[model samples]
Target: MEKITPKVDIAFKKIFGVEENKDLLIDLINATVAPEDQVVEVTILNPYNPKSFSNDKLSILDIKAVGQTGKRFNIEIQITDESDYDKRALYYWAKLYTEQLKVSQNYATLNKAIGIHILNFISITDSKKYHNVFHITEKESGLPYFTDLELHTIELSKFSKD
Candidate 1:
């Protein structure tokens, strides 16, 4: 018997990036989402197939999908800590959000883009918690003003360590 390191980029992709294991993905995702916005089903946009994993182990292996509620989702697992990782998450979220609309599509047609980043390092030092959800809210009241954009950061190091 050998130890399987799921935290590795390719292993993580292989586990959750396929359509067959969508239930596992949905369950994991549901734990981080609100009860009202819980996802029952998701259509995987970029699925992983072992037949052609490519020679590159560091290829962009984000699990892209759309939930049953018309919300777009981008799930990425980062084992190696990178500089400006927060910005990278935001950039990916923005790219996914903006790409929904075309030259003729109405603004209202755009759905919510949710970015789920699983990091093996500590990104947000302010919070001691392992999981953090970000949204655009009112500064004074702290009420949610915008619900279209949501970002989730799950720091694995904090969870397994502290």
Candidate 2:
């Protein structure tokens, strides 16, 4: 029998965004995020629910979780190459990062937010690397200004079974 591809957005969300698959999600996050930013465990903040999208047609099935260290993780799978994919990803990342703070909460209380994008097509065509990580840094010094925000992109088209 053929296996269903988890690369599909719904399938991806269903597999990694469930409470029962918490361990699997944690392992996946640890493998995807930077070594220094790895997490021991993660709690599914927004667990997958098919009914949740039944009313909204524009909703993207992305997995949202919070790590033991308080860092937030958003995982998304894209099979089609949208024109404004980069901007859309950044918008989602920024939304998640900023939404951590309440009206009276301090900025320091905000936790690191990471967005991981698994793309079936080559989003970054300039590079052949399957895995890429982005961080805010000083241009001349090449030093990270703040490690609070991170974005990871995995090009499935560049992946090989070998």
Candidate 3:
């Protein structure tokens, strides 16, 4: 049998975005977040359904989910290396974070948005680690200034199967 590698968006969505495999998704979320911020449950907002990808134009298979708490999680897997991937991840985070505010809803009511990007190619050359987390911070103090927006990149190419 040919194994479906997560480098392909369909396989990643099938494994992590579907409702039936939510436990797996929760585990991933928990691993991504801090220990104190770990979630016990996760609700897949956009579950992977084969019918959902029937059209060629609808090929962007990104996963959207909510934690037991109010945090919103956006996950996507990219096979090719895009030099502008950082900007793309930030754009996704902003989109998800802004979408949480409904009509007449308070700005404080917006939930924390987290974007997880799994790439088959390397983007961060400075870091040897496969996983790297980024947050808005003061350049001088190097302290986080924004906690609501968080982005994580998992470079599959940097990871060794061993």
Candidate 4:
């Protein structure tokens, strides 16, 4: 593995985008935001490296931002046509939520985590609109659920402003 120095400044803006979504993101993570709760800072973790040196050389133009709400979010810009999209989304969501627990903190102290994947691939089925949210729950009772920890996936290819 070649050692690449992380250019923390320009890379951060490129991934997160200097747009209104930055503000909207703060609201999204906090669930509801007050008018005065200005988004003070945005931190991107080290694992958020855009470069992936796997089989295919590709960069994820995605943003992993943490806001004042103590919530972490993974937003990805994906353009791929594939099956089992729902399962793939779940995998990423779980990976983010579970990885938050530190050795000292318990589940109660873990901050709310979410993985938002926005894809621009055309759907194979009749389903047109693209936003999906997922949460942890039981199969049988289906009673216990965490309202804070959530996941959202949007298919941009099938979206319409109208």
Candidate 5:
């Protein structure tokens, strides 16, 4: 019998996007995100649904969760290379961050938004590292401008079985 890979979008969602498997998702998030911001618990905002598979192609299978610390995480697995993948990730992160605030809500009410992109192909070809974290910072001062927005890319192609 052939084993199905969790790297596939649907399989990934079924494994990590359900309420019962929240522990797995938390563990994954803790391992992927910065150690300082590690979360012990998380609430799946969009749990998996078997009925949605028929319309899967028309929608994103990303997992959305909120940590105990109030931080939001968007985890996605991408197998194919899309030219606008980077921009789309940023846009989703920004949307999630801004959407936290209501019409009369203050800007301070917004929580940190983190995006984790698991890619089957190399995104940053120049680097040998499989994992990369991105943040907004001042170019001249090398100081972080905004720490609320974080993006992580994990290239599966760089992983070794050993």
Candidate 6:
């Protein structure tokens, strides 16, 4: 057996390096979330297959994450901006949320589902914010419609050097 000691760097990219630490994703999940119910239950969504999506689809380079605590997280590094990105994100977000409801499951049984996008290219929107979070909300009263479904996106292009 061999033991290896590595140097440390001060950056989120260092902690969550993309090329390696694929499995460490689970660790990130474990750290970011804490559930009130059973902590024994945990699952990591892996959508790395090019064929997992449609035949000609660009394919998901990797997955964000979903937790048993009804929390979802997505961390992606994208270099290009595709058309209808807003719709695309929504489509995937809905897919993650609805996929949980099987043949005989109630709505309450559904856990929190989230999608996170790390875009390397500038988004079409004019907003200068670095991050965005989406949640169900009422139209009139402006109250959260539900806390179970969540979406988060981080724009790396806007990341500044201060």
Error of 1 at 20 (Å): 1.5
Compared with the true structure, the alpha-carbon lDDT of candidate 5 equals 0.84
Q: What TM-score does model 1 achieve against the real structure? A: 0.85
* lDDT of candidate 1 over 53-149, digit per residue (tens): 4583322437888898788888888888899998888877877777678799989999988889989899999998898999998999999977898
Top lDDT: which candidate number?
A: 5
**Every model: Cα RMSD to truth:** 5.3, 4.0, 4.7, 8.5, 4.6, 7.1
- TM-score rank, highest first? 5, 2, 3, 1, 6, 4
Point out where model 4 deviates above 4 Å.
1-41, 48-61, 122-127, 137-144
Q: Backbone clashes per model, in order?
A: 0, 0, 0, 0, 0, 2
lDDT agreement of model 4 with the native: 0.57
lDDT of 2: 0.83
TM-score of each: 0.85, 0.87, 0.86, 0.60, 0.88, 0.64
Cα-based RMSD of candidate 4: 8.5
How would you encode candidate 3's per-residue C-alpha lDDT over 52-93 as one tens digit per residue?
Answer: 245622223389888877898888889888779888788677
Question: Which parts of model 6 have CA positions greater than 4 angstroms off?
Answer: 1-42, 48-61, 68-70
Residue-wise C-alpha lDDT for candidate 4, range 1-162, written one tens digit per residue: 964322243443453555544665555444423343335665665443332346733323255666675676676655556688667666555556666666888778677667766666754345655776666688898765886557665666667788
Given candidate 3, what's the lDDT at residue 153?
90
Better of 2 and 5 by lDDT: 5
- Considering only N, C-alpha and C atoms within 3 Å, which residue pairs clash in candidate 1? none
Model 6, total clashes = 2
Tell me which residue pairs clash in candidate 2: none
What does candidate 4 score on TM? 0.60
Tens digits of lDDT, candidate 6, 1-162: 853322112243444544365456666444433344223334445554233446644434245455556555554555577877777777667666666677888877877766666676667467787676667899898799787666566676787876
